[model samples]
Target chain A: MKALNRYARAVAELLVLFALYALGTWLAQALGWPIPGGVVGLALLLLVFALNGLKPAHLQLGAGLLMAEMLLFFIPALMSLLDYGALVRQQGLRILLVIAISTVVVMLVTAFTVDAVFRWRMRRDT
Target chain B: MTLEPMPLAWLGLTLLAYLGSRWLYRRTRIYVLSPLILVPALLLAIAAPLHTRYAEYSADTHWLMAVLGPVTVAFAVPIWQQRALLVRHWAALLLGMLAGSLASMLSSWWLARWLALDPAVALSLVPRSITTPFAMPLARDLGGVPEMTAVFVMFTGVFGAMLGGVLLRWLPLRSPLARGALFGVGAHGAGVSRAQEVGREEGTVAGLVMVLTGLLNLFAAPVLERFF
Candidate 1:
């Protein structure tokens, strides 16, 4: 009975989430908004969450399932590399080098900036 | 027009490959063994042998891509879960994200230019630091290949997460906010996972920062694409 109730609640939660997603997508397409429907739905859902329309506990199970299995959904996109043979063959090594250097740069600069601001705030507060 | 038939067999193959690779990744904890890399390699190995084009594969698996939109919507949950951190560190968060996003964008463009990559590939690199869900759309808006952007984003996440750990040692980040922001701003999804291993607060902050960065970039991509 406990497990049943939990599963049932999860189903309801998933319904709400999907509904918001659909609505957001519809609105985006209809209104011709620049934002993606998923994003619009995210904002709308966040708004609902803030207004106390729902609790995190209510959506936890459903949201967790979707997010945890997300990699499953992206496999095809990754596999789409089957398409760009010429590009990959010609520039793959260079693209990798660019990604490595840029990633390191972003990390160092972001970390240092955040640490600086944190220390500055602490000093001002004191 | 005749619709392409549902690719049940290919779908099954794709699923088995991804789930199996994930299991393998868990056992090894090696980045090379990860599903992101393993799944693609596995599929491509079969694909090339069979001469399966990407369009044929996508026709069968687009349902997975369609769900990506809803998966993206689910990010709001994590961001909401970390509202207190969001409220407390808005200043640090905004400044760090701006610095990181700007740095990543500039560095990617310069590197792409320095390497003389095709113009399309150069633009795709612009959103490489963000997570896949956000990066793919942004890449398309900028007239870059979305799939290629996904690969670049994946590589960025892997390198950023790996390098973020090394940077943490040399940097003077006392607070969880700074430490997590390092991963979040640097690596997005992959960094969130790495940040979770460091500590709970770091994980929370990293997750929040990642989601917010994706959102901020989504809102700004329209204008930023013009620059690219």
Candidate 2:
């Protein structure tokens, strides 16, 4: 009974999230906002949390599952590469090289910069 | 559109491949076996042999992509809960996002010249690090195909997620703040999920950073258009 109840709660929470996403999508379309509906919905949820209207636990199970399996959502987009034939044939290897090298450099620079700034603050606080 | 027989089969195959890959990754702890790399590679290999068209495959599985929107919204929960930590690390987070976004655009531009890529292709490549929603508009305004830009964004994201962990091992990142920001800044959307596996703090911080990175790029894109 308890496990079933927990499952039900997660489904309910997911539905709530889905509702917000739909509302945000509609609002963006209706208002001609430059932002995506997902972002608008995120802002709404942020407002709710900021106002103490909900806690993390309220959406924990559902959100956790959604996020953990998030890679599943991205595979389709990556698979779209199959469509760009001529472009791929000509620039595929080169583009991949550029992206690969740059992504590594960007990750390193960002991580080091953040670490340095964090340490500087720590030293000041001390 | 409704789920037709072919797309439905493709969808089921996607799910099975991902689940199987996830299991292999857990069992063997191989980086390549992770869903980010394995599932896409598996599907793409199968797709080519079957002579599947991109349009049909994309249209059939469109709903999966649509679900990304709600999953993105779902990020708000962790971001809200992690407000306290975020406040404390504001300075680092801000600087890191700025540096990361600039590095991404600049590196693409710098490297594109060596590749001798056409001007338009180069522009699309520049915004590859930003999420598609923001990157597409930037690409369009800058005389690149938004569709091509989407593909580049996907490639960068998948690569970033793959590299984030490998990079972590090499860096002496001591805080969840540092570790999480690495993925968020470097990888964007896909990185957030990768960070979640690291820990809740890392996940929350990554969620916060990815959204902030998107907004930062969106704002800077206008100033960038003039320069491009």
Candidate 3:
């Protein structure tokens, strides 16, 4: 009975989340906004939380469940590889090289730049 | 065997394979064994021999995709939890993310052009640094192939998550904020996940940066298209 109640609550929380996302999608479509509905939904959720319209606990269970299984959502994208076999074969190495080098460069640049800026600010203040 | 029943079967297979792969990743903690890498490989292996079409598999697994919106929105909870940190370092974080995001876009454009990729393909590569949800629409707006943008975004995330640690070690970064910003800017969702594993502060800052950078890129994409 306890487990059943918990499951029911989870379902209810998930429903609320889905409804908010749907509303966000509707708003974005109605406005013809270029931003994705999911992001608009994120903005809405952030506003609601900031204004204390909903406590974190209200969405915690559902959000936690989704975050824990987030990787599952991406599997389809990876699976779509089957459709891109030819493209991958033709330009796979080149694409990989660009992604690899850029990722490292971005990481190094961002990290070091931020670190440098923060240290420089501290030194100036001191 | 029936066509109508196949979606359910495929869904079950996805779940089982993910669970098995996740268990192996947990037991070994090997980066390559991570579920993100392994499950897809496992699916591709099964898919080829079984004659499973990507379209069919995707249609069957659309329910999982549907949850992505909510999952993206759900990220707000974590970001909200880090509101204090965001408020304190808003200037630094924002500047860092903006620089990082621009660097990612410019570098990708330069490399794609240098490599002489198709113009459309090069355009798709421009938004590779942003999270997929935002990157897809941005790519579409810029006349790039959204699907190809998704692939680049995923590859960027995986590479950032996999190599970010090794690269960070060689850098002179001692601050969690700087490290987190790097991961979030370079990696998107996967890098944020990796950041979370490192420390709470790192994860929180990374998540905040990821959200902010993604939102920033939405506005920046149009401006970027003019150059590329």
Best candidate according to TM-score? 1
Interface RMSD of each: 1.1, 2.2, 1.5
lDDT (Cα, tens digit) per residue for candidate 2, span B153-197: 877877888889888888898778888888888887778878988
Tens-place lDDT digits, model 2, residues A16-115: 8888899889998999876668878888888888788988788888887777777787677677677776778998899999999989878888888898
Best by DockQ: 1
In angstroms, give how far residue B202 of model 1 lies from its true place: 1.3
Docking class for model 3 is medium
| Candidate 3 chain A minimal-lDDT segment of 10 residues | A74-83
lDDT of 1 at A64: 83
Relative to the true structure, candidate 1 reaches a TM of 0.95
- Greater TM-score among 2 and 3 belongs to 3
lDDT of 1 by residue, B1-228 (tens): 112354476788888887888898889898888877778787787778777788888878889988878878888898888788778878988999999999999999999999999999999899988877888888888888898888888888878878888888887678888899889988987888899989998988888888788888878887897888
Model 2 residue runs over 4 Å out of place are: B1-7, B130-154, B161-176, B189-204, B219-227
Summarize candidate 3's per-residue lDDT along B1-228 as a digit string, tens digits: 124555477788889988988899889988778778888888888786766667788777877877888887887887888788888777678888878987888888899889888788888888898877677778888889876887788889888998988876777787998989988999988898899888888887887788788788887766866776
Model 1 error, position B129 (Å): 0.7
Better-scoring candidate (lDDT), 1 or 2: 1
- Compare candidates 2 and 3 on DockQ and give the better one: 3
* TM-score, per-candidate, Cα-based: 0.95, 0.86, 0.93
2 or 3, greater by lDDT: 3
What are the DockQ scores of the candidates, in order?
0.80, 0.63, 0.71
